[model samples]
Target: MEDRKKDHIDLAFSSRLNGDMVDNRFDYEPMLGIHGKKDLSFEFADKIMQLPIWVSSMTGGTKRAGTINKNLAQACGEFGLGMGLGSCRILLDSPEYFDDFNVRPIMGDDVPLFANIGICQLEQMLQNRSEGELDELVDKLQADGLAIHINPMQEAFQPEGDVLKTPPIELLKKYLEKTDLKIIVKEVGQGFGKESLRQLLALPLEAIEFGALGGTNFSLVELNRSEAVAAEVYNPFIHIGHTADNMTHTINQLVDKMGYKIKVNNVIISGGISSLLDGYYLTEISKMPAIFGMGSAFLRHSMGSYDKLQSYVEKLANGLQLANNFLRVKL
Candidate 1:
């Protein structure tokens, strides 16, 4: 554990000071494009919804995580938003953990729920699992879609992180071709750029979650747990990547330039989305149908007391309403 902590710190420092220009380009316009004028209503695998805002993927391994996910699902159901569960790796690997992670009780048939798994874990599924086995996992949770998260930086920072051996684009294409369900291409903390997005767009994907850097700094998380060398390498770039606002704008612009050639079902603007205004601004500026908020701030107010959670949900709802009204008049 001590050595792991050191490795994190090294990776953090290296990433921060490395002086790499993080790319931020989108093929769509910021306003008045395919996503802006087109009807937001769309079918996500088995679920259909009018709103685009979704409760972004968080955690679901421990009891506390399960509680959080349950509350989040309830909130999502109430708000008419989509919801995604955290990585199912631990649960899939350990039956004991799976028994404890109860997401079904919180999910609703009407709500769009997505099951998440990492690229590294895809190898496990390919080894012995059949389509029916994978489908059973989603069926058990009543998920509407499957999200495959890419987080090489997160892994490199973590001491026990999986070494990403190859590019996942081919694997993702295979999964897309095989699954009869919606496949969401997501990033963990490091946001996606033009090249990566183009590659993903080539696949038959349902959506993209640009998990921009700003909210949760997993690199920093690893740094706190890392040691000498890794810490030094990754510490400087704590705020290394693009902000949520920048990423959203870029993606919107990129999608517009592409002339709506790629049928991206949704664009999830996550990371650093805190207050109602942040949500409002993101929804206004981006062409994507929805925005995702994942940090503890939103969850902190939503968990435990129903009234408190309701109030928090209302605030976000009001913000979206305001944005929609303003867009109606402006556009």
Candidate 2:
């Protein structure tokens, strides 16, 4: 105790924070709440998640992907969280990389696991009348549903990117009419505009994951891979997307205006969600039932070892519980 007090005294001068460093979004009511036993459990994707955290899709079909996915699945299983696999495009015609994404056994049957595919790939399947492969892909992985990531900007920036022959909404409508498979639609870095969100809310989607701006921008990713001139010319386009807060406000207004017209009831407030506070704030403001997702954050820890990933997930759960117990969003 003496040593601890000495250390505290030594660090006290350096630990002083400025008034501008305060977080004003939440009202910290320490007196009204105790850090007693708290339950952060919530139902999402038809599964009860102990922590409202989703491991957003990051990578697959790479050398390190197997180890990373194994670590991630084990973390989710241990923490009782949900996960979305990186693009399962490689699994469409080949089973060679199937083991990398086959994480259901590791995560168990209790948590939600969703397979991901790009909207461009879906369009191609529809064009060739090979959409049946999608269902087969989902069944092979034992996934509860599928997440269709829409990345028009990323595709446009890629030199060898697939052409989006049809609008994503039209493709989604066509696919929904034929399949009973549960579906989620998300963006890649750049989030949806107001009109896009309106059309999506009208669909029978299981959920909408806002892969909003401020995270890993795939458009910027593709741009970096391009020649210098192309990258320079297209740099401005990378900043044209919406943030999590912007999307949340837009959805809330739409809900108020549309009433029963809003078909999708759940949302995964992803992108730019750097901390538990960001997740808590966005989810609190959203009118729909919401959880938060992280891609790069989980991928970074999962690349090392299962023990590292497990520790990180435990910290995430504890931090979120603390936020829920003490912080309230200021209206």
Candidate 3:
């Protein structure tokens, strides 16, 4: 069982694809009325933000992951966006062994910070702890909310992936009952469809991050580790999911027509958002508090010296400001 799980995780992480290239078909437009300085101070429940973006969860299970999380948190603190720590399962599983990992330094007092754990992990958490323990962890971390990531595609491609015995929506409801912290249901990469959204909405969720298909292809990730039959079977499906644009349209239409009012605390469109223009377009079209959480880009940038990291942040800021300016015109 353990070997199978290891194989699954290895396959999921092995995908040698960059998020920026896969979702590059989008065109940039200068939309008027998008800029009008409409106070961008949004919130994840009570957490306030100068901008509507957050650095989405990237990594933190291993030492290398911890370094990435540290840099990411620092970037989030510098830029006024929220930061999400990657899966804390390893840390939670063996706190002493991973005691070196820390999230406080990368986070800011005012900016939002999110704790991440998979849906399967949540189900296990529900069995072990009382409600208070969950609440305490939120309070301890000073996190504004908890992100329950849904990544069945990665799992399905994983050689030893956990057999998802039950629907995650049910587990999500269980978590909702136990914590006061807002619950955010997010996809890792594969975008959510209407049926999936419907199931998610049935649970008490604060927001949704449509980690759409156009960005990071989990199938490609699996393909890197897969051999023989599995690789061939999965490789063809790399482009099978919805793009960020499609997801935005679908979710907006659902709210507009279906009257399926899920708090929609925010709509994070984070598949192929690489440039300032990309971020702007997503915010304009989705019309929700959006985020351009560039996991792979950030990872690559961080591989260099601190100066390079700083430069990357500068570029991101410039892009955001440019987008803001472009959107302010009254079309």
Go through the candidates in order and give the C-alpha RMSD of each one to the true structure.
12.3, 0.9, 11.8
> CA shift at 48, candidate 3, in angstroms?
2.5
Residues 1-331 of candidate 3: C-alpha lDDT, one tens digit per residue? 9999988898986867886665443434566425434455666666666666667777655667666677766766776677776776665657663432366655668787877778766766676665455565566666777788887767788776655666887777676776777777888777788888766655666678777887766556766777789887777767677777788778766666646456555777777766666666667766445555556677787654656777887776665655565534222
State in Å the error of residue 48, model 1: 4.1
Q: TM-score for every candidate vs. truth? A: 0.78, 0.98, 0.80
Regions more than 4 Å wrong, model 3:
1-40, 97-101, 127-136, 327-331
- Cα displacement (angstroms), candidate 3, residue 135, comes to 3.9
lDDT for each candidate structure = 0.69, 0.91, 0.68
Estimate, for each residue in 1-331, the C-alpha lDDT of model 2 and write its tens digit.
Answer: 9999999999999999999999999998887777665888878768888888889997788779988998999988889999999999988767899999999999999999999999999999998999998899999899999999999999999989998989999999999998988899999898999999999999999899999999999999999999999999999999999999999999999999998999896899999989878998888888998989998889888888688888888888878877878888898
Residues 303-331, candidate 1: write the lDDT tens digits: 57567776877666665554554443222
Order of candidate numbers by TM-score, starting with the best: 2, 3, 1
Give lDDT for model 1. Answer: 0.69
Clashing pairs in 3: 15-221, 32-329, 33-329, 35-327, 35-328, 215-271
lDDT of 2: 0.91
lDDT of 2 at 194: 97
